[model samples]
Target: MGEKLNISPGELRASAHAADTITKDLGRPLSKALEDIAAAADSLRHWSVGPQLKATGEGWGSALGKLRGRVGEHADGLRMVAAGHDVNEENVLNRFKGW
Candidate 1:
């Protein structure tokens, strides 16, 4: 006998929703922080360390952008999985109805 795999589409969707919320939550604050860093870097451009600071800030911004994109992709994958499971379940039920 094969082991049963119980899948919950609702749970998957909820998790995806949570991930989306997290992405949104991080985006607002981090974006503001980056803007502040950029402004500070501009203000201190004459100082020797100003360019370094700006470069570091840009690096962080790029990394964060990649992270955000990955998280969004994860959320999309979760939704896709949930929908696939839902369709599979529906097809199974329809087969049983014929019996």
Candidate 2:
């Protein structure tokens, strides 16, 4: 009566790897770009709107940092899930080896 649940460890691992790649590929470059923009804004300190622009860039950087952290956490969670499932499956198979 219960629905069957199917999990593919390989797929989970692949997804985790993709997440990690995304974090690595995008995170550093984007963070660096934001810092550069903030630095550029700082150069305009004499202008009335320069401080606002700098603040905006810093805020975006902070938000991106949080997002990167969250993505990393998700990747870790996915890997853990995949490994756990593999172990569980192995344990189940071992229990039935004598049958």
Number of the top-ranking candidate, with lDDT as the measure: 1
Tens-place lDDT per residue, model 1, 1-99, is 233555589988998999899888999888999999999999999998889889999999999989998888899999999999989999999989957
Off by over 4 Å in 1: 1-7
Across 35-83, the per-residue lDDT of candidate 2 in tens digits comes to: 7888889899899788989998889888988998899899999999999
Number of clashing residue pairs in every model? 0, 0
lDDT of 1 at 29: 89
Judged by whole-model lDDT over C-alpha atoms, candidate 1 comes out at 0.91
In model 1, the number of clashes is 0
TM-score of 1: 0.88
* RMSD after CA superposition, every candidate: 2.5, 2.2
Task: Please give the range of 10 consecutive residues that has the lowest summed lDDT in model 2.
Answer: 1-10
RMSD of 2: 2.2
Lowest summed-lDDT stretch of 10 residues in model 1?
1-10
Candidate 1 displacement at residue 43 in angstroms: 1.8
Off by over 4 Å in 2: 1-5
lDDT of 2 at 48: 79
* lDDT values for all models: 0.91, 0.88
